[model samples]
Target: MLAACRGFVFDLDGCVWQGEVLSPGAGEVLTALHRAGRRIAFLTNNSRATGPAIRAKLHRLGLAFAEHALTPLEIIGSVVAERFGRSRVLVIGAPELTAAVRAGGHDIVDVAAFRTATVVVVGNDFELTYERLAAAARAAAAGAPLVTPNVDPRLPIEGGDFLPGSGAIVAAVATAAGVRPVVVGKPESPLFRMALRRLGLEPAEAAMVGDSLESDVAGGRAVGMRTVLYAPGAPPAPGAADLVVRSFVELARAAGVG
Candidate 1:
């Protein structure tokens, strides 16, 4: 089922790396696919870091194909610009996300201007506070559009650790504001479409590989792409993905690559 695809899309946090440590056999599988002339795109829902930062980290990790990487950070600007015209934006995310929104010809306003904010963009804010959350909630409650990356509750990290993801933050605002945010990342069509565009392949010609069955698998399936679940531990459910692999080695074998 996996051998027919000419291109592949991978998720970052779990499938490629668990944190600063790269997942075992990930580089080998990617190299084999590249050598076999398969187009690949790295689509991550991680909104904390920009694309360049991720590329630099990939370089440091000695992973090739850094050029094919995309994160919510890189595409957020365009997503915002196209969704909402230039207006006052309240950003409850990292500095990089703020910069992206500003670069989109939107004004980044603080909590003081929440009442007048045209839209509220939410991501993972490390320095989150009740004040910030309340302001963002108020802004959204006041009819400002709310946008976020993905709602993955947990982010996989090294040593089998996890962190609260952007979804956690988005959830807080959503509950308080009583509004479902406009999601631009996984489980949504925008990011998947962007990844396909980058690879220049139709959904039928490529596969989406990631750990999250809800986000990656569902998102890919929504776009009519085959799905591969990189589940290293627990047993996969019946028909969760088109294919399920315990490691990149297994994925390579299944895909009939090197």
Candidate 2:
């Protein structure tokens, strides 16, 4: 099934690399695919990152294709601007996320003025504080719409360690605010459709390769694309993906690449 696909959508951070360390044989596989003229797209949920920064990292990492890359930041601003129009946003994320909201033409209100916020936006806040959390929650609780990039529970880092992801932080605010946020990233349709459109392929003609079963596999499956679960050093769940591989090398073999 994987060998027949025309396009391959890869998830960064985990599938292609774990933080600074590239996944074993990832570069070779991607290079081979690119040489074979396979359509490729890199989709990431890293809200703190920008498109140029991500592309720079990939170039340094030895993946040379100039494929279009998507980060939550690239789409976050547009999501807000299109849906809510110009409004005050109580942003609870990093500086990059704040810039996205600003670029979308939304005003970032101080948390102290949470009552005046027209929307509560959340994402990865590495320097999260109780105060920021409280203010965002208060804004959402008071009936401002809560919006978020993605709800990934944990993020993989260097040395095989993990950090609390955006979802982990969003959970706290959701519990306190008593509202479910409007999620814009994976496990959601917009990002998946955006990637598919970039590839110019119907869902069946493409495959989504990622480490997260929930975000990558389920999202791909929902859109009728084949899903490849990259379960390195662990047994993959049964029936979760159309194809399962232990590593990029294995995936390359299955896809008849490299």
Candidate 3:
């Protein structure tokens, strides 16, 4: 399936590794693909890190790609800037995401000043607190549009455990504010559109490989790209992927790599 494609998009966390450690065969398969002259883009919804930081992590794990990695922060931040130009924003996310927003020329305001915010962005905040939630909810309720990077409820970490992702925080704010957030990550068309633009390929000409059924598989399929679900030791959840593989070695072989 991969051999026919000119471009590839990979999800970073579970597909490449689980927290800094490269997955078995990940480096080899990726290196093989790179040698094959296929355009590759790493798409990640984790707003906790910036694109350069993610690229550095990939380098540390011995994987390199020519294209700059795309993250939700860049996509969403661009949208926010274009739509609201230098407006005050209430950000409840990681420091990396906050920095990204600030770099986009938006003013990051304190929760107490939520009334002045033009948009409210929610991401993974390990230090979430009730006070922050209340402030975000109040702002959203008062007409500030709620924006979330992704709606992933949980994120996989090392040791095979999962932790609450940005979705959890978004859900809380949504519930309190009585408004749904605009999700800008995978399973949404904006991020996929941006990726397709970067790859210079139509959706049908590319393949998306990732471990998550919802964000990766479903999102890829939604964008009309072929999807490959990498679910090790798990049976294919009917119609999940065009091809399901257990390991990157199998994926490499499927892609016509030795």
Candidate 4:
């Protein structure tokens, strides 16, 4: 049931690898797809890494892909900058998130420098505290637009349990400030649209593959694209995907990629 598509989009981290442990045969699948001359892009909501960084990680894992073949924090940054401008933006995120914002020509402001903020961008911050949360809430309550990178609740780490993602932080800030943030990540966001545009493919001809039902499957399905759920240890939802597999290799097989 996986032999008719022109392009493929993959969600990183879970579907491809988890915390440096490459999913079994993941690289072989990607290698096969490349050999078959199929268009591939690694789509991710990991706002913690830039495209180059993600590319570096993939290279280290023995996967080969062009720099333009990945999208993550860069897209989110563009969205924020386009909507909120480059100056006076308060960010509650990690280095990559902040860097993405800055790369888009925006100024990053700390919570203490809140009075001048026109927007508040939130992502995964390991150093989060009540003070920062309160400051973000105040900024939002003061009429700053709230933008989130993605809503993944947890991220897999090498030897540790899943770490809380930006979603957890977004939930807390929204609850405290009584406002819902505009999320630019997956499952119901324009970020996928951005990817579609970048690939020059209509939504109907593109397919989204990921390991999660929330962002990858749900988000892709919501946008009318064929969706694949790669649940290595989890099962696909009853009716959430067009295809289900244990690895992206199955995705290539289905898409006639190799």
Q: Ranking by TM-score, best first?
A: 2, 1, 3, 4
Compared with the true structure, all predictions reach lDDT values of: 0.88, 0.89, 0.86, 0.78
Candidate 3: list runs displaced more than 4 Å: 83-86
lDDT of 1 by residue, 1-258 (tens): 888899999999988999998899998888888888889888899878877888888888887666778887777777878888777999998888898888878888988778989999999999899999999999999999999877889889998999999999999999999999998889888788988998899999999999999999999999999999999999688788988888899999988984
Q: Looking at candidate 3, what is the lDDT of residue 52?
A: 80
lDDT (tens digit, per residue) of candidate 2 on 17-131:
8998788888888889988889999999887888788888998888767567888887887888788888899999999999998999899999788899999999999888899
My TM-score estimates for the predictions, one after another, are 0.96, 0.96, 0.94, 0.89
Error of 2 at 52 (Å): 1.8
Worst 10 residues of 2 by lDDT: 62-71
Clashing residue pairs in candidate 3, if any? none
Q: Judged by TM-score relative to the true structure, which candidate is superior, 1 or 4? A: 1
Relative to the unseen true structure, what is the Cα RMSD of model 4? 2.3
Candidate 4 lDDT (Cα, 0 to 1): 0.78
Candidate 3, poorest ten consecutive residues by summed lDDT: 59-68
**lDDT tens digits, residue span 143-219, model 4:** 89899888788887665458888899999988888888988778665767777777778777878888888889888
Between candidates 2 and 3, name the one with more favorable lDDT.
Answer: 2
The residue ranges of model 4 lying beyond 4 angstroms of the native Cα positions read 85-87, 256-258
Question: How far off is model 1, as Cα RMSD?
Answer: 1.3
